[model samples]
Target: MSALDIFENDSDDTKSAIMRATYHALCEHGYANLTIQRIGDEFAKSKSLLYHHYDSKDELLVDFLEFVLEKFKADIPAEEYDDPCAHLREVLDHVVPPTLDAERYEFTSAMIELRAQAPHDEAYREQFSRNDRFFRQQFADVVRDGVETGAFRDVDPEQAAALLVTTINGSMLERVTTDDAEDAIRATRRELDAYIDSHLLAESGE
Candidate 1:
Protein backbone atom coordinates (compact mmCIF):
# COMPACT_ATOMS: atom_id res chain seq x y z
CA MET A 1 0.00 0.00 0.00
CA SER A 2 1.02 3.58 -0.53
CA ALA A 3 2.27 5.26 2.63
CA LEU A 4 -0.46 7.88 2.38
CA ASP A 5 -3.03 5.08 2.57
CA ILE A 6 -2.36 4.96 6.30
CA PHE A 7 -4.34 8.16 6.78
CA GLU A 8 -7.37 6.52 5.22
CA ASN A 9 -7.97 4.22 8.18
CA ASP A 10 -6.83 6.54 10.95
CA SER A 11 -9.10 6.57 14.01
CA ASP A 12 -8.88 10.31 14.43
CA ASP A 13 -10.59 11.75 11.37
CA THR A 14 -9.40 15.31 11.91
CA LYS A 15 -5.79 14.40 12.51
CA SER A 16 -5.86 12.05 9.54
CA ALA A 17 -7.23 14.75 7.29
CA ILE A 18 -4.60 17.18 8.44
CA MET A 19 -1.82 14.66 7.96
CA ARG A 20 -2.97 13.79 4.47
CA ALA A 21 -3.18 17.48 3.62
CA THR A 22 0.28 18.07 4.93
CA TYR A 23 1.58 15.20 2.79
CA HIS A 24 0.10 16.70 -0.37
CA ALA A 25 1.37 20.15 0.53
CA LEU A 26 4.86 18.83 1.11
CA CYS A 27 4.77 17.03 -2.21
CA GLU A 28 3.77 20.18 -4.05
CA HIS A 29 5.71 22.93 -2.30
CA GLY A 30 8.51 20.75 -0.94
CA TYR A 31 10.17 21.10 2.49
CA ALA A 32 11.83 24.47 1.87
CA ASN A 33 8.69 26.20 0.60
CA LEU A 34 5.98 24.50 2.68
CA THR A 35 3.77 26.64 4.91
CA ILE A 36 0.56 26.42 6.94
CA GLN A 37 -1.36 28.20 4.21
CA ARG A 38 -0.28 25.69 1.61
CA ILE A 39 -1.34 22.83 3.82
CA GLY A 40 -4.60 24.55 4.63
CA ASP A 41 -5.33 24.87 0.96
CA GLU A 42 -5.25 21.10 0.72
CA PHE A 43 -7.23 20.60 3.94
CA ALA A 44 -11.02 20.37 3.74
CA LYS A 45 -11.64 21.76 7.20
CA SER A 46 -11.21 25.33 8.37
CA LYS A 47 -7.72 26.76 8.36
CA SER A 48 -8.30 27.67 11.99
CA LEU A 49 -8.39 23.98 12.86
CA LEU A 50 -4.75 23.63 11.81
CA TYR A 51 -3.80 26.63 13.99
CA HIS A 52 -5.78 25.12 16.86
CA HIS A 53 -3.49 22.11 16.88
CA TYR A 54 -0.11 23.46 15.79
CA ASP A 55 1.38 26.89 16.24
CA SER A 56 4.10 26.37 13.62
CA LYS A 57 4.56 24.43 10.42
CA ASP A 58 7.49 22.55 11.90
CA GLU A 59 5.41 21.59 14.91
CA LEU A 60 2.73 20.06 12.71
CA LEU A 61 5.35 18.34 10.56
CA VAL A 62 6.95 16.76 13.61
CA ASP A 63 3.62 15.26 14.52
CA PHE A 64 3.11 14.24 10.92
CA LEU A 65 6.44 12.40 10.96
CA GLU A 66 5.38 10.57 14.10
CA PHE A 67 2.09 9.64 12.51
CA VAL A 68 3.83 8.26 9.45
CA LEU A 69 6.24 6.26 11.57
CA GLU A 70 3.47 4.65 13.60
CA LYS A 71 1.48 3.78 10.52
CA PHE A 72 4.61 2.44 8.82
CA LYS A 73 5.23 0.03 11.69
CA ALA A 74 1.69 -1.22 11.43
CA ASP A 75 1.90 -1.64 7.67
CA ILE A 76 4.80 -4.07 7.69
CA PRO A 77 3.69 -7.70 7.76
CA ALA A 78 7.06 -9.13 8.70
CA GLU A 79 5.62 -12.00 10.69
CA GLU A 80 3.28 -13.08 7.95
CA TYR A 81 6.04 -14.53 5.81
CA ASP A 82 7.01 -18.08 6.83
CA ASP A 83 10.27 -18.12 4.90
CA PRO A 84 13.12 -15.93 6.12
CA CYS A 85 14.50 -15.44 2.64
CA ALA A 86 11.10 -14.37 1.38
CA HIS A 87 10.72 -11.96 4.27
CA LEU A 88 14.15 -10.46 3.65
CA ARG A 89 13.49 -10.09 -0.06
CA GLU A 90 10.15 -8.42 0.63
CA VAL A 91 11.79 -5.93 2.96
CA LEU A 92 14.46 -5.16 0.39
CA ASP A 93 11.83 -4.69 -2.31
CA HIS A 94 9.89 -2.29 -0.13
CA VAL A 95 13.02 -0.17 0.37
CA VAL A 96 14.37 -0.39 -3.17
CA PRO A 97 11.45 -1.02 -5.43
CA PRO A 98 11.69 -2.34 -8.97
CA THR A 99 10.25 0.91 -10.32
CA LEU A 100 9.61 4.46 -9.18
CA ASP A 101 6.36 5.88 -10.44
CA ALA A 102 5.50 9.57 -10.20
CA GLU A 103 3.72 9.37 -6.86
CA ARG A 104 6.41 7.24 -5.26
CA TYR A 105 9.10 9.47 -6.66
CA GLU A 106 7.43 12.62 -5.31
CA PHE A 107 6.83 11.14 -1.86
CA THR A 108 10.38 9.81 -1.61
CA SER A 109 11.82 13.13 -2.67
CA ALA A 110 9.82 14.96 -0.01
CA MET A 111 10.91 12.46 2.64
CA ILE A 112 14.58 12.82 1.63
CA GLU A 113 14.22 16.58 2.01
CA LEU A 114 12.96 16.01 5.53
CA ARG A 115 15.91 13.73 6.18
CA ALA A 116 18.30 16.44 5.05
CA GLN A 117 17.04 18.62 7.90
CA ALA A 118 17.86 15.98 10.52
CA PRO A 119 21.35 17.31 11.33
CA HIS A 120 20.04 20.77 12.29
CA ASP A 121 16.61 19.78 13.67
CA GLU A 122 16.63 17.77 16.85
CA ALA A 123 13.08 16.55 16.52
CA TYR A 124 13.62 15.43 12.94
CA ARG A 125 16.86 13.79 13.92
CA GLU A 126 15.25 11.88 16.75
CA GLN A 127 12.39 10.64 14.62
CA PHE A 128 14.75 9.54 11.85
CA SER A 129 17.02 7.83 14.37
CA ARG A 130 14.07 5.91 15.71
CA ASN A 131 13.11 4.90 12.21
CA ASP A 132 16.66 3.81 11.43
CA ARG A 133 16.83 1.70 14.58
CA PHE A 134 13.49 0.09 13.79
CA PHE A 135 14.59 -0.84 10.26
CA ARG A 136 17.96 -2.15 11.41
CA GLN A 137 16.39 -4.30 14.07
CA GLN A 138 13.82 -5.63 11.64
CA PHE A 139 16.57 -6.70 9.28
CA ALA A 140 18.68 -8.18 12.04
CA ASP A 141 15.76 -10.15 13.37
CA VAL A 142 15.10 -11.69 9.97
CA VAL A 143 18.75 -12.53 9.51
CA ARG A 144 18.86 -14.14 12.90
CA ASP A 145 15.80 -16.22 12.03
CA GLY A 146 17.40 -17.29 8.78
CA VAL A 147 20.58 -18.35 10.56
CA GLU A 148 18.65 -20.33 13.17
CA THR A 149 16.69 -22.10 10.44
CA GLY A 150 19.85 -22.82 8.48
CA ALA A 151 18.39 -20.94 5.54
CA PHE A 152 21.31 -18.53 5.55
CA ARG A 153 25.03 -18.85 6.17
CA ASP A 154 26.39 -18.15 9.64
CA VAL A 155 26.96 -14.43 9.88
CA ASP A 156 26.69 -11.56 12.33
CA PRO A 157 23.09 -10.56 11.95
CA GLU A 158 23.66 -7.06 13.31
CA GLN A 159 26.54 -6.37 10.93
CA ALA A 160 24.63 -7.73 7.95
CA ALA A 161 21.59 -5.65 8.85
CA ALA A 162 23.71 -2.52 9.21
CA LEU A 163 25.30 -2.99 5.82
CA LEU A 164 21.93 -3.59 4.10
CA VAL A 165 20.31 -0.61 5.79
CA THR A 166 23.17 1.70 4.87
CA THR A 167 23.13 0.51 1.27
CA ILE A 168 19.37 1.00 1.01
CA ASN A 169 19.54 4.50 2.51
CA GLY A 170 22.32 5.52 0.16
CA SER A 171 20.44 4.13 -2.82
CA MET A 172 17.31 6.03 -1.80
CA LEU A 173 19.21 9.31 -1.54
CA GLU A 174 20.78 8.79 -4.95
CA ARG A 175 17.43 7.85 -6.49
CA VAL A 176 15.87 11.08 -5.31
CA THR A 177 18.74 13.49 -6.06
CA THR A 178 20.51 12.12 -9.12
CA ASP A 179 19.39 12.30 -12.74
CA ASP A 180 20.36 8.69 -13.41
CA ALA A 181 18.01 7.36 -10.74
CA GLU A 182 16.64 4.41 -12.71
CA ASP A 183 20.11 3.20 -13.50
CA ALA A 184 21.21 3.62 -9.90
CA ILE A 185 18.22 1.73 -8.54
CA ARG A 186 18.74 -1.07 -11.02
CA ALA A 187 22.38 -1.35 -10.04
CA THR A 188 21.46 -1.32 -6.34
CA ARG A 189 18.98 -4.15 -6.77
CA ARG A 190 21.51 -6.26 -8.66
CA GLU A 191 24.21 -5.73 -6.00
CA LEU A 192 21.75 -6.43 -3.18
CA ASP A 193 20.70 -9.72 -4.76
CA ALA A 194 24.32 -10.66 -5.30
CA TYR A 195 25.08 -9.85 -1.66
CA ILE A 196 22.23 -12.07 -0.55
CA ASP A 197 23.44 -14.92 -2.73
CA SER A 198 27.09 -14.77 -1.73
CA HIS A 199 26.87 -13.75 1.90
CA LEU A 200 23.42 -14.59 3.16
CA LEU A 201 21.86 -17.70 1.58
CA ALA A 202 23.12 -21.14 2.59
CA GLU A 203 24.18 -23.38 -0.28
CA SER A 204 21.64 -26.07 0.56
CA GLY A 205 18.88 -23.50 1.04
CA GLU A 206 19.69 -21.79 -2.26
Candidate 2:
Protein backbone atom coordinates (compact mmCIF):
# COMPACT_ATOMS: atom_id res chain seq x y z
CA MET A 1 0.00 0.00 0.00
CA SER A 2 1.19 3.49 -0.77
CA ALA A 3 1.19 6.34 1.73
CA LEU A 4 -2.38 7.39 0.90
CA ASP A 5 -3.70 3.82 0.87
CA ILE A 6 -5.05 4.24 4.37
CA PHE A 7 -7.35 7.09 3.29
CA GLU A 8 -7.90 5.64 -0.18
CA ASN A 9 -11.40 4.21 -0.43
CA ASP A 10 -14.76 4.82 -2.09
CA SER A 11 -16.47 5.16 1.30
CA ASP A 12 -14.00 7.88 2.26
CA ASP A 13 -14.75 9.68 -0.98
CA THR A 14 -18.50 9.64 -0.35
CA LYS A 15 -18.05 10.87 3.18
CA SER A 16 -15.77 13.59 1.91
CA ALA A 17 -18.39 14.56 -0.63
CA ILE A 18 -21.00 14.83 2.09
CA MET A 19 -18.68 16.98 4.18
CA ARG A 20 -17.80 19.27 1.27
CA ALA A 21 -21.47 19.86 0.55
CA THR A 22 -22.00 20.62 4.19
CA TYR A 23 -19.05 23.03 4.23
CA HIS A 24 -20.32 24.97 1.23
CA ALA A 25 -23.70 25.19 2.92
CA LEU A 26 -22.07 26.45 6.08
CA CYS A 27 -20.14 29.10 4.16
CA GLU A 28 -23.01 30.31 2.03
CA HIS A 29 -25.75 30.16 4.63
CA GLY A 30 -24.13 30.33 8.06
CA TYR A 31 -24.48 27.60 10.69
CA ALA A 32 -28.09 28.43 11.61
CA ASN A 33 -29.16 27.71 8.04
CA LEU A 34 -27.16 24.50 7.83
CA THR A 35 -29.88 21.91 7.91
CA ILE A 36 -29.95 18.37 6.57
CA GLN A 37 -32.10 19.57 3.69
CA ARG A 38 -29.59 22.23 2.69
CA ILE A 39 -26.63 19.86 2.44
CA GLY A 40 -28.74 17.28 0.65
CA ASP A 41 -29.80 19.94 -1.82
CA GLU A 42 -26.23 21.13 -2.26
CA PHE A 43 -25.07 17.66 -3.23
CA ALA A 44 -28.20 16.77 -5.22
CA LYS A 45 -28.75 13.92 -2.82
CA SER A 46 -31.56 12.80 -0.53
CA LYS A 47 -31.78 13.82 3.15
CA SER A 48 -31.70 10.16 4.10
CA LEU A 49 -28.48 9.71 2.19
CA LEU A 50 -26.87 12.67 3.93
CA TYR A 51 -28.20 11.52 7.29
CA HIS A 52 -26.60 8.13 6.70
CA HIS A 53 -23.20 9.83 6.87
CA TYR A 54 -23.95 12.38 9.58
CA ASP A 55 -26.42 11.74 12.40
CA SER A 56 -27.30 15.28 13.48
CA LYS A 57 -26.58 18.93 12.76
CA ASP A 58 -24.10 19.00 15.63
CA GLU A 59 -22.35 15.92 14.29
CA LEU A 60 -22.09 17.60 10.93
CA LEU A 61 -20.71 20.74 12.54
CA VAL A 62 -18.05 18.72 14.34
CA ASP A 63 -17.12 16.97 11.12
CA PHE A 64 -17.07 20.22 9.20
CA LEU A 65 -14.73 21.95 11.68
CA GLU A 66 -12.62 18.83 11.87
CA PHE A 67 -12.38 18.89 8.11
CA VAL A 68 -11.28 22.52 8.18
CA LEU A 69 -8.72 21.73 10.90
CA GLU A 70 -7.29 18.90 8.83
CA LYS A 71 -7.04 21.18 5.82
CA PHE A 72 -5.35 23.83 7.96
CA LYS A 73 -2.74 21.31 9.03
CA ALA A 74 -2.10 20.42 5.41
CA ASP A 75 -1.92 24.04 4.26
CA ILE A 76 0.61 25.04 6.92
CA PRO A 77 3.98 24.13 5.42
CA ALA A 78 6.63 22.70 7.71
CA GLU A 79 9.31 25.25 8.43
CA GLU A 80 11.95 22.52 7.83
CA TYR A 81 14.45 23.85 10.30
CA ASP A 82 16.04 22.27 13.38
CA ASP A 83 16.17 25.52 15.30
CA PRO A 84 12.89 26.17 17.09
CA CYS A 85 13.08 29.91 16.70
CA ALA A 86 13.82 29.76 13.00
CA HIS A 87 11.12 27.17 12.36
CA LEU A 88 8.66 29.29 14.33
CA ARG A 89 9.67 32.28 12.23
CA GLU A 90 8.78 30.20 9.20
CA VAL A 91 5.33 29.52 10.66
CA LEU A 92 5.07 33.18 11.60
CA ASP A 93 5.21 33.75 7.86
CA HIS A 94 1.66 32.40 7.63
CA VAL A 95 0.04 32.62 11.08
CA VAL A 96 0.30 36.35 11.93
CA PRO A 97 -1.50 37.17 8.81
CA PRO A 98 -1.95 40.24 6.82
CA THR A 99 -1.02 37.84 3.99
CA LEU A 100 -3.94 35.42 4.27
CA ASP A 101 -6.01 34.21 1.36
CA ALA A 102 -9.79 34.09 1.06
CA GLU A 103 -9.75 30.48 2.20
CA ARG A 104 -8.10 31.46 5.48
CA TYR A 105 -10.57 34.29 5.94
CA GLU A 106 -13.49 31.90 5.46
CA PHE A 107 -11.99 29.43 7.88
CA THR A 108 -11.55 32.17 10.46
CA SER A 109 -15.16 33.24 10.13
CA ALA A 110 -16.34 29.66 10.52
CA MET A 111 -14.22 29.33 13.65
CA ILE A 112 -15.66 32.50 15.13
CA GLU A 113 -19.17 31.33 14.40
CA LEU A 114 -18.43 28.01 16.01
CA ARG A 115 -16.99 29.72 19.06
CA ALA A 116 -19.97 32.01 19.41
CA GLN A 117 -22.32 29.04 19.43
CA ALA A 118 -20.21 26.99 21.81
CA PRO A 119 -22.12 28.03 24.91
CA HIS A 120 -25.46 26.88 23.57
CA ASP A 121 -24.01 23.65 22.22
CA GLU A 122 -21.89 21.77 24.70
CA ALA A 123 -20.80 19.04 22.28
CA TYR A 124 -19.52 21.52 19.74
CA ARG A 125 -17.48 23.35 22.36
CA GLU A 126 -15.90 20.11 23.55
CA GLN A 127 -15.17 18.77 20.08
CA PHE A 128 -13.91 22.10 18.83
CA SER A 129 -11.67 22.56 21.85
CA ARG A 130 -10.31 19.02 21.50
CA ASN A 131 -9.54 19.54 17.83
CA ASP A 132 -7.90 22.87 18.64
CA ARG A 133 -5.71 21.27 21.29
CA PHE A 134 -4.62 18.61 18.83
CA PHE A 135 -3.69 21.31 16.35
CA ARG A 136 -1.67 23.23 18.92
CA GLN A 137 0.19 20.08 19.92
CA GLN A 138 1.64 20.02 16.41
CA PHE A 139 3.56 23.24 17.15
CA ALA A 140 4.52 22.28 20.69
CA ASP A 141 6.30 19.19 19.43
CA VAL A 142 8.52 21.28 17.19
CA VAL A 143 9.23 23.87 19.88
CA ARG A 144 10.08 21.26 22.49
CA ASP A 145 12.43 19.42 20.17
CA GLY A 146 14.11 22.63 19.18
CA VAL A 147 14.61 23.65 22.81
CA GLU A 148 16.14 20.29 23.75
CA THR A 149 18.74 20.82 21.07
CA GLY A 150 21.02 23.85 20.96
CA ALA A 151 19.00 25.20 18.08
CA PHE A 152 16.51 27.04 20.27
CA ARG A 153 17.29 29.17 23.27
CA ASP A 154 16.34 27.66 26.60
CA VAL A 155 12.93 28.89 27.75
CA ASP A 156 9.30 27.91 28.32
CA PRO A 157 8.38 26.07 25.16
CA GLU A 158 4.77 25.75 26.28
CA GLN A 159 4.31 29.50 26.70
CA ALA A 160 6.16 30.18 23.47
CA ALA A 161 3.93 27.73 21.68
CA ALA A 162 0.79 29.27 23.19
CA LEU A 163 1.92 32.74 22.18
CA LEU A 164 2.20 31.67 18.58
CA VAL A 165 -1.26 30.10 18.47
CA THR A 166 -2.99 32.92 20.39
CA THR A 167 -1.49 35.61 18.19
CA ILE A 168 -2.88 33.96 15.05
CA ASN A 169 -6.29 33.61 16.70
CA GLY A 170 -6.25 37.21 17.93
CA SER A 171 -5.06 38.55 14.57
CA MET A 172 -8.02 36.90 12.84
CA LEU A 173 -10.34 38.63 15.29
CA GLU A 174 -8.59 41.92 14.58
CA ARG A 175 -8.80 41.34 10.82
CA VAL A 176 -12.58 41.43 10.51
CA THR A 177 -13.17 44.86 12.05
CA THR A 178 -9.99 46.60 10.93
CA ASP A 179 -9.92 48.59 7.68
CA ASP A 180 -6.43 47.39 6.68
CA ALA A 181 -5.68 43.94 8.09
CA GLU A 182 -2.40 43.62 6.27
CA ASP A 183 -0.89 46.75 7.76
CA ALA A 184 -2.08 45.87 11.28
CA ILE A 185 -0.83 42.31 10.96
CA ARG A 186 2.58 43.50 9.77
CA ALA A 187 2.91 45.64 12.86
CA THR A 188 1.67 42.74 15.00
CA ARG A 189 4.24 40.42 13.45
CA ARG A 190 7.13 42.69 14.37
CA GLU A 191 5.90 42.94 17.93
CA LEU A 192 5.51 39.17 18.18
CA ASP A 193 9.12 38.61 17.08
CA ALA A 194 10.35 40.99 19.72
CA TYR A 195 8.15 39.32 22.35
CA ILE A 196 9.65 35.95 21.46
CA ASP A 197 13.16 37.29 21.71
CA SER A 198 12.52 38.71 25.16
CA HIS A 199 11.01 35.52 26.52
CA LEU A 200 12.89 32.73 24.73
CA LEU A 201 16.32 33.92 23.65
CA ALA A 202 19.12 32.90 25.98
CA GLU A 203 21.61 35.38 27.34
CA SER A 204 24.78 33.30 26.92
CA GLY A 205 23.68 30.74 24.40
CA GLU A 206 23.29 30.27 20.65
Candidate 3:
Protein backbone atom coordinates (compact mmCIF):
# COMPACT_ATOMS: atom_id res chain seq x y z
CA MET A 1 0.00 0.00 0.00
CA SER A 2 1.45 3.34 -1.11
CA ALA A 3 1.44 6.35 1.22
CA LEU A 4 -0.65 8.25 -1.30
CA ASP A 5 -3.03 5.33 -1.51
CA ILE A 6 -3.93 6.36 2.02
CA PHE A 7 -5.34 9.52 0.43
CA GLU A 8 -7.37 7.40 -2.01
CA ASN A 9 -5.84 9.18 -5.03
CA ASP A 10 -3.38 7.53 -7.41
CA SER A 11 -1.98 10.64 -9.10
CA ASP A 12 -1.65 12.44 -5.79
CA ASP A 13 0.05 9.39 -4.36
CA THR A 14 2.68 9.37 -7.08
CA LYS A 15 3.35 13.09 -6.71
CA SER A 16 3.50 12.74 -2.94
CA ALA A 17 5.94 9.84 -3.23
CA ILE A 18 8.14 11.92 -5.48
CA MET A 19 8.04 14.79 -2.99
CA ARG A 20 8.83 12.51 -0.08
CA ALA A 21 11.84 11.17 -1.95
CA THR A 22 12.93 14.71 -2.75
CA TYR A 23 12.66 15.74 0.90
CA HIS A 24 14.70 12.76 1.98
CA ALA A 25 17.33 13.55 -0.62
CA LEU A 26 17.37 17.19 0.42
CA CYS A 27 17.81 16.40 4.07
CA GLU A 28 20.49 13.84 3.33
CA HIS A 29 22.30 16.02 0.80
CA GLY A 30 22.31 19.76 1.25
CA TYR A 31 20.98 21.85 -1.63
CA ALA A 32 24.55 22.31 -2.87
CA ASN A 33 25.01 18.57 -3.39
CA LEU A 34 21.50 17.26 -4.05
CA THR A 35 20.95 15.23 -7.24
CA ILE A 36 18.13 13.28 -8.86
CA GLN A 37 20.11 10.08 -8.29
CA ARG A 38 20.25 10.83 -4.57
CA ILE A 39 16.52 11.43 -4.43
CA GLY A 40 15.90 8.12 -6.22
CA ASP A 41 17.64 6.38 -3.36
CA GLU A 42 14.81 7.51 -1.14
CA PHE A 43 12.05 6.85 -3.64
CA ALA A 44 10.04 3.64 -3.43
CA LYS A 45 10.09 3.21 -7.20
CA SER A 46 12.79 3.21 -9.87
CA LYS A 47 14.88 6.29 -10.63
CA SER A 48 13.61 6.17 -14.20
CA LEU A 49 10.11 6.97 -12.86
CA LEU A 50 11.43 10.24 -11.39
CA TYR A 51 13.29 11.11 -14.59
CA HIS A 52 10.12 10.41 -16.53
CA HIS A 53 8.32 13.00 -14.46
CA TYR A 54 11.11 15.59 -14.10
CA ASP A 55 13.87 16.35 -16.59
CA SER A 56 16.22 17.80 -13.97
CA LYS A 57 16.92 18.01 -10.26
CA ASP A 58 16.18 21.74 -10.13
CA GLU A 59 12.74 21.25 -11.63
CA LEU A 60 11.93 18.48 -9.18
CA LEU A 61 13.29 20.43 -6.21
CA VAL A 62 11.20 23.49 -7.05
CA ASP A 63 8.05 21.40 -7.24
CA PHE A 64 9.07 19.67 -4.03
CA LEU A 65 9.43 23.07 -2.36
CA GLU A 66 5.95 24.04 -3.46
CA PHE A 67 4.58 20.80 -2.04
CA VAL A 68 6.32 21.34 1.28
CA LEU A 69 5.13 24.96 1.55
CA GLU A 70 1.55 23.97 0.81
CA LYS A 71 1.73 21.30 3.51
CA PHE A 72 3.15 23.82 5.97
CA LYS A 73 0.32 26.22 5.28
CA ALA A 74 -2.28 23.51 5.65
CA ASP A 75 -0.80 22.34 8.96
CA ILE A 76 -1.35 25.68 10.71
CA PRO A 77 -3.82 25.29 13.55
CA ALA A 78 -6.74 27.16 12.08
CA GLU A 79 -9.39 26.73 14.80
CA GLU A 80 -7.82 24.60 17.48
CA TYR A 81 -7.00 27.36 19.99
CA ASP A 82 -9.76 28.71 22.20
CA ASP A 83 -8.87 32.37 21.63
CA PRO A 84 -6.99 34.48 19.15
CA CYS A 85 -4.18 35.18 21.61
CA ALA A 86 -3.65 31.47 22.14
CA HIS A 87 -3.90 30.93 18.41
CA LEU A 88 -1.29 33.58 17.73
CA ARG A 89 1.02 32.08 20.32
CA GLU A 90 0.62 28.68 18.74
CA VAL A 91 1.50 30.13 15.37
CA LEU A 92 4.70 31.65 16.73
CA ASP A 93 5.62 28.43 18.47
CA HIS A 94 5.03 26.55 15.26
CA VAL A 95 7.52 28.73 13.41
CA VAL A 96 10.32 28.28 15.93
CA PRO A 97 11.62 24.75 16.44
CA PRO A 98 10.56 23.75 19.96
CA THR A 99 12.90 20.80 20.36
CA LEU A 100 16.43 19.85 19.38
CA ASP A 101 15.39 16.75 17.49
CA ALA A 102 17.99 15.71 14.94
CA GLU A 103 15.46 15.10 12.18
CA ARG A 104 13.81 18.46 12.66
CA TYR A 105 17.17 20.19 12.67
CA GLU A 106 18.23 18.50 9.44
CA PHE A 107 14.95 19.36 7.74
CA THR A 108 15.08 22.97 8.89
CA SER A 109 18.71 23.29 7.85
CA ALA A 110 17.88 21.99 4.38
CA MET A 111 15.00 24.48 4.10
CA ILE A 112 17.22 27.38 5.10
CA GLU A 113 19.78 26.30 2.51
CA LEU A 114 17.06 26.27 -0.12
CA ARG A 115 15.79 29.67 1.03
CA ALA A 116 19.29 31.10 0.62
CA GLN A 117 19.03 30.31 -3.07
CA ALA A 118 16.02 32.61 -3.49
CA PRO A 119 18.26 35.51 -4.51
CA HIS A 120 19.71 33.69 -7.52
CA ASP A 121 16.78 31.53 -8.63
CA GLU A 122 13.58 33.07 -9.88
CA ALA A 123 11.39 30.05 -9.11
CA TYR A 124 12.74 29.84 -5.58
CA ARG A 125 12.39 33.59 -5.15
CA GLU A 126 8.74 33.53 -6.21
CA GLN A 127 7.88 30.58 -3.96
CA PHE A 128 9.62 32.10 -0.95
CA SER A 129 7.91 35.45 -1.61
CA ARG A 130 4.56 33.70 -1.55
CA ASN A 131 5.48 31.84 1.65
CA ASP A 132 6.57 35.05 3.36
CA ARG A 133 3.48 36.97 2.33
CA PHE A 134 1.19 34.15 3.45
CA PHE A 135 2.64 34.03 6.95
CA ARG A 136 2.69 37.81 7.25
CA GLN A 137 -0.95 37.95 6.34
CA GLN A 138 -1.74 35.09 8.68
CA PHE A 139 -0.04 36.77 11.61
CA ALA A 140 -1.77 40.06 10.84
CA ASP A 141 -5.13 38.37 10.60
CA VAL A 142 -4.70 36.69 13.96
CA VAL A 143 -3.68 39.95 15.59
CA ARG A 144 -6.63 41.71 14.04
CA ASP A 145 -8.90 39.00 15.34
CA GLY A 146 -7.53 39.35 18.86
CA VAL A 147 -7.94 43.13 18.89
CA GLU A 148 -11.45 43.01 17.45
CA THR A 149 -12.42 40.37 20.00
CA GLY A 150 -10.96 42.44 22.86
CA ALA A 151 -8.48 39.71 23.77
CA PHE A 152 -5.55 41.93 22.82
CA ARG A 153 -4.84 45.62 22.86
CA ASP A 154 -5.31 47.68 19.71
CA VAL A 155 -1.99 47.72 17.83
CA ASP A 156 -0.72 47.89 14.29
CA PRO A 157 -1.23 44.33 13.18
CA GLU A 158 1.21 44.57 10.30
CA GLN A 159 4.06 45.86 12.40
CA ALA A 160 3.46 43.31 15.14
CA ALA A 161 3.25 40.58 12.55
CA ALA A 162 6.52 41.63 10.99
CA LEU A 163 8.27 41.58 14.35
CA LEU A 164 7.07 38.08 15.10
CA VAL A 165 8.07 36.64 11.73
CA THR A 166 11.42 38.41 11.63
CA THR A 167 12.29 37.21 15.11
CA ILE A 168 11.45 33.65 14.13
CA ASN A 169 13.64 33.87 11.04
CA GLY A 170 16.48 35.34 13.06
CA SER A 171 16.24 32.50 15.54
CA MET A 172 16.38 29.96 12.73
CA LEU A 173 19.54 31.55 11.36
CA GLU A 174 21.12 31.58 14.80
CA ARG A 175 20.25 27.93 15.26
CA VAL A 176 22.20 27.04 12.13
CA THR A 177 25.44 28.43 13.57
CA THR A 178 25.26 26.80 17.01
CA ASP A 179 25.56 23.25 18.27
CA ASP A 180 23.27 23.92 21.21
CA ALA A 181 20.29 26.05 20.19
CA GLU A 182 18.10 25.42 23.22
CA ASP A 183 19.30 28.51 25.04
CA ALA A 184 18.71 30.79 22.10
CA ILE A 185 15.30 29.30 21.39
CA ARG A 186 14.28 29.74 25.04
CA ALA A 187 15.46 33.36 25.10
CA THR A 188 13.44 34.08 21.98
CA ARG A 189 10.33 32.50 23.49
CA ARG A 190 10.75 34.55 26.63
CA GLU A 191 11.08 37.75 24.64
CA LEU A 192 8.05 36.87 22.57
CA ASP A 193 6.05 36.23 25.71
CA ALA A 194 7.08 39.60 27.11
CA TYR A 195 6.19 41.26 23.83
CA ILE A 196 2.75 39.71 23.92
CA ASP A 197 2.17 40.81 27.48
CA SER A 198 3.35 44.37 27.04
CA HIS A 199 2.10 45.12 23.54
CA LEU A 200 -0.84 42.89 22.86
CA LEU A 201 -2.53 41.96 26.11
CA ALA A 202 -3.89 44.36 28.68
CA GLU A 203 -2.34 44.58 32.14
CA SER A 204 -3.86 42.09 34.53
CA GLY A 205 -1.64 42.26 37.61
CA GLU A 206 -3.80 42.73 40.67
On TM-score, the leading prediction is 1
Model 2 per-residue lDDT tens digits across residues 119-162: 88887888778765864786788777867775557766677767
Point to the candidate with the largest lDDT: 1
lDDT over C-alpha atoms for residue 71 of model 3 = 73
Residue 205's lDDT in candidate 2: 48
Candidate 1 stretches with Cα past 4 Å from truth are 8-12
The ten-residue window of minimal lDDT in model 3 covers: 1-10
Off by over 4 Å in 3: 1-12, 78-80
Better of 2 and 3 by lDDT: 3
> Which wins on TM-score, candidate 1 or candidate 2?
1
**Residue 34 of model 3, lDDT score:** 92
What TM-score, to 2 decimals, does candidate 3 have? 0.87
lDDT of each: 0.85, 0.68, 0.76
Poorest 10 consecutive residues by lDDT, candidate 1: 1-10
TM-score of each: 0.93, 0.77, 0.87
Write down the RMSD of all candidates, one decimal each.
1.8, 4.9, 4.1
